[model samples]
Target chain A: MSHGRPVRRRGRPASAERNAGEPATRDRILGSARTEFAERGYDKASIRAIARGAGVDSALVHHYFGTKEQVFAAAVQGAFAPAMGIPDLLLSGDREEWGERLVGYIFKIWEDAVTRDPLLAIMRSAVSNETAAAIFRGLISRNLLERVSAGLDRPDAALRVELALAQLVGTAMLRYVIKVEPIASAPAEELIPRLAPVVQRHLTG
Target chain B: MSHGRPVRRRGRPASAERNAGEPATRDRILGSARTEFAERGYDKASIRAIARGAGVDSALVHHYFGTKEQVFAAAVQGAFAPAMGIPDLLLSGDREEWGERLVGYIFKIWEDAVTRDPLLAIMRSAVSNETAAAIFRGLISRNLLERVSAGLDRPDAALRVELALAQLVGTAMLRYVIKVEPIASAPAEELIPRLAPVVQRHLTG
Candidate 1:
C-alpha cells in the first residue's frame, strides 16, 4: 500500500528468520532499479548499477529479480501499483462519471513527482527501446487495460480501453514529459473538465 | 514536396552561381540530421556525425543549420511538413467531418515509414532531452497548433487543438512507437471510427 515502494505479495513465508529483512531489501532493490532506469534509461541501465544504487550485492538483486528485464518489469509493476486500483475505482463508481473519475485519478498521479517520475522513466525507455517497450506493452495490456476491459460488457471493450488510455497518455506526454504548452502550463482543473468528456465518450459512448 | 526530405522555402536566392545545388545540399544535411537524431537521440547526436552521414563537412552542417538545437528544429519542421497542411484540411472540410478527415490523414502519414521515421526520431529526442523538447514545443506551437487554432472562433480553441492532438499523439505512441497490441495490430480502419468521435468532440464540441 506504500505509494512508491514495491508491494510485497501475499503467500510468501512471513516468519522465516533468514527472510526477516527480505521485504525491505527487496523494496530497496526495486527503488534502486527505478532510479537507475529513470536516470540511465532502459538500454543504458544495468543490473550492477541498480544493485549498487540499492547498496546491495548483485547476487541479491539477481536472487530477487531474475534478469535485467525482470528487474525492469518489477520496477514497472511497482510504479504502476498506485494506479492499479483504477479498475476497482471504475467498477465502484457510477458508469456515467467514469470519464471524470479516470481523468481525475490519472492527472493526480501525473501531478505528483513521486509517482510521475517512475511512469515518465518507463515511458522514455519504452519509446526508444524494443525490449522495454515490450515490457511496458505486456504490463499495461495485462494489468491495466484488461482489467478495465473486463468491466465493460461490450465486445470491443479492449480497443475502447486503449483509445481512452491513448487520450490520457498523450495528454501526459505533452503536459509532463514533453512539456508542451498550453497543455503543459494549463492548470489541471482547467484541463480535467475539457478532457473528461472525451474520455467518457471513448469508454461509454 | 518529397515525403521525407526537408522542404526548402522560396525566399532563398535561386540563381547565385555559388548557390547552385544549394537546395539539394541543404536537404541532404537535414536528412542526415534526422538520421543522427533518430539513431543517437538528441543528446548523443552530433553535427560531425550528421555531416559525415551526408558526406559533407561539419562546417557545412553548421552553415545550413546553426546549432544542434537549430538543426533539430529544422528536422522537426521538415518531419512535420507533411502534417503542416492539417490546418487547411480542417478548414476546408465539412466542419462535422473534420475529425474523420484529421484522424484518417494522420494515420496515413504514420502508416508510411518514410514520413513516420523522422517523426519517431523527433519524438524520441523530444521525450528524452529538454532542449529537444523545447524546440519541438516551439515548432509545433508556432507552425502547427497556432495555425489550427487561428481557424477556430472559440476563445478556448488553442486548448482544444492541443487536447485533440494529445489524443492522436498518445495513440501514435501506443500503436506505432510502443507497438501495444490490440491497438497496435488493430487495423486503422477499425480505429478511425472509434477515435474520430473523441477528436471531433475536442475540436468542435
Candidate 2:
C-alpha cells in the first residue's frame, strides 16, 4: 500500500516516517475519519477504526491527528475547505454585497455533489451527537464567525454572525439534508435574490 | 394498568374497545410515542415499544395511531402545539410587528425547558435521519409555511416564507440544539430585536 515508501510499524510519529512534504498519507487518514464519523457517528468513531479503514497502523493515525477530536476537526476543515475561506470571501468584495456573495457561494456548494457529500456527513453527525456538534460549532467560530465579527466593528457581532449563519445553515438543512420541497426544488437564482437581502440585514442592519 | 378502562388485547381493534370522545387513551398513547421517538429516534421507535411505554397494549397504540408515521405526526403536533397557531398569532397582532412576535414566541419555546426538550429531540433526529427529516419538513410546510404564504399575497410568497422560517429554525438549531455560544446565552430581548426585522422583511419586503 505504501508503494515502496518506508512503512513505520506502531508508535512512531507519522510525520517522521512519511516522505517529507507528502500530505497524501494525512489526506488518506482524514478521508477514513470522515467515513468513520459519518457511518458510526462521533461517539462510536474511534481512531483505531479510522486507521483500519485507511489501511494504516492505529499509532500512525494517532501520530498524525493526536486525538479523535483533532481528527474530527481535520475532517470538518477538509469537508468545508471550499467555504473555509468565507472570511476572505466576505472581505474581498464590498461589505454591502456580503449577503449576495455569501449566499451565492454557499448555494453553489450545496448544489454540487462532490462538495455537498462531506458537508452532509458532518452535518448529520453534528446534529446527532454533542461531540460532533461542538466540533462543528468550533469550526464555524474559528473559520467564519470570529473573522466576520472582526470585520463588522459592531456591537453584538457574535450574535449577529450566528443569526445570519443560522439562516443559511437552516436553509441548507431543509433543502439538502431534509430534502424539503419547494425550497429543495427551487433553482438557486430564485433563492439567492430572496435570501441575500435577509442575510445582508442580519449582518449589516 | 388501564385502571378498569377495558384493556384490549394485542389482536383486537383498539378504538372499538374504548369509549368514544374520551381522548385520555389517545393522549396517553401520544405521550408514550413522544418519549419513544425522542429517545430512540424515528427509525428505531416502534408501536409495540411505545405501547409498552404508555402502559397499554400494542393494539391500542395501533388503534389510536395507525402506524409509526401517524404516531410521529401526532407527537410532532403535540410538541409544537404552542406554535401551531402561528397564522392566528400573526393575524391577532399588528401586522407590522409580525417579526417581533414570531421571533419572541420561538425564543420562548427554545428558552423554556418544558418546550425545548421535544423540539431538541426532533431537531437532532431529523438532522441525522431522512424519515424524521421528511416529517419535520412536512410539518413546517403544512403548519407554518402554508399559513405564512397565504397571508403574503406577494410573488414568490412560498420562497419568502421559507427563508424567514430558515432564519428562525437555524437559530433554534444552533442555540438550542447545538448550543452554540453567544446566541445560545444571550437574553431573548437582545436577539428578538435583531432577528425580528430580518424575518419581517422576508415576509413583507
Candidate 3:
C-alpha cells in the first residue's frame, strides 16, 4: 500500500502508466507530466521535467512509463476520465434539452477544482504538443466521440458528434486555456441552459 | 492537419497563403510557405520542401524569411492577419438574430475552397504542433483577438471575445479539420443562420 511504488494491473491496456490507485506514484507522475507538458509542450517535456514536477527520480518515470509519449497518453485519458460518463448520463433520458445538459456538464467539470487545473493542462498540452495532441485525438475519438456519436439517431450523427465536440471544447478552450473572463467565471448553472440547446442541436435536435 | 486548404487575414490581414490578387514570386513563396508549413507543420516543414512546393529555390525561403522561426512567424502573420469587422456586421443594431448572422459569416469563410483549406491546416497545426501553435498564438493575440474584443459593451467583453472566438474556431475545426459531414458539406447559406445567433450573443447580444 506504499504510494511510492505503484503496481500495474495485469492484462490491462498497455498505454500510459497503469493507474495503480488514487494518488499513486504513477498518477502523481502523470499529473505532473500533464502540467509540465501543458506549460512547455512535447519537445520541451522531458522525463526529468516530469519527474521534477512529480518529486520522483527520472528513472522512476521510465520504470513506470516507458516514454514521455506514453506518459502524455495517460495524462489525456486521465483528463477526461471525469466525463467518461457523459454519454451514459446523456443517453439515459429522452432527446429533449440534451444540448443544455451536455454544455452544463462540461462547464461544471471545467469548474471543479480537483479536475479543472489538470484537465486544462491536458487540454493545452493536447493542442500545444505533438505527442500529446495525438494522444488527445485518439483518446477523444475513441472514447467520447465514438460513444456519444453512437447514441445519436441523426443521419448525420457523426457530424453532430464533431459539432458538439467543437462547441464544448471551444468553450473549454476559451474559458480555461485562454482564461477568458465571464464565461470563465460565470456560474456553471447559468452557462448550462444557454449552452445546452447548442449542444442539443448537435446531439438530438 | 491534412494540407488541403488556402488562407485568411484581419480588417483582413494580407496573407501568405494566396497571391490571388498578385502573382509575384514573393507572394507565391509566402503562399507556398503557408501550405507547406500548415500541412507539414513548422518542424516537418523544411526550407527545401517549401521551395519544392512553391517551385522556388530553398535559398529563396532563407532569403525572404531568414530562418525557420522567421519564416514561421511570417507565414502565421500572413495567414491569420487581422481583417475588417464581422462584429461590425453583427453589431449593426437591435441585433435580435445576431447569432444566426454571426455563425453564417464564419461558416462562409470555411466553406470556400479558396480560404477554408489553408486555414484548416494552420489551425490544426497551431494546436498539435509546437512551433506552429506558437505562431498561431502570436497571430491571434496580436492581430485577431484585440479586434474581436474591441467595441464589445458586455460586462465581460474579453470573455465574450474568447467565447466568440471559440464559437467561430470550433465551427471551423469541426467542419473542416475533422470533416464532420453535413457541417462540412452543408451549403454555407444553410449553416450560417444556425450559427450566427450564437456568435451574435458572444458579440453584442
**Candidate number of the best DockQ:** 1
* Residue A184 lDDT (model 2): 89
Off by over 4 Å in 1: A1-25, A55-60, B1-25, B57-59
DockQ metric for all predictions:
0.63, 0.62, 0.22
Lowest lDDT 10-mer window, candidate 1 chain A? A9-18
Task: Estimate candidate 1's alpha-carbon lDDT, on a 0 to 1 scale.
Answer: 0.85
Candidate 2 structure lDDT: 0.80
Candidate models: Cα lDDT each: 0.85, 0.80, 0.65
DockQ preference between candidates 1 and 3, better one: 1
Full candidate order by lDDT, most accurate first: 1, 2, 3
Interface RMSD of 1: 1.1
In candidate 2, stretches whose alpha carbon ends up further than 4 angstroms from where it belongs are A1-15, A18-29, A44-70, B1-32, B45-63, B91-94
Retained native contacts per candidate, as fractions?
0.73, 0.72, 0.31
Per-residue lDDT of B48-144 in model 1, one digit per residue for the tens? 9999999988887776678998899989999989988798999886989989999999999999999998898899889877888888888888887
Please tell me which model should have the higher DockQ, number 1 or number 2. Answer: 1
Off by over 4 Å in 3: A1-23, B1-82, B91-101, B111-164, B173-205
Worst 10 residues of 1 chain B by lDDT: B9-18
- Please say which candidate is ahead in TM-score: 2 or 3: 2
CA error at residue B7 for candidate 2, angstroms: 10
- Give the DockQ ranking, best first: 1, 2, 3
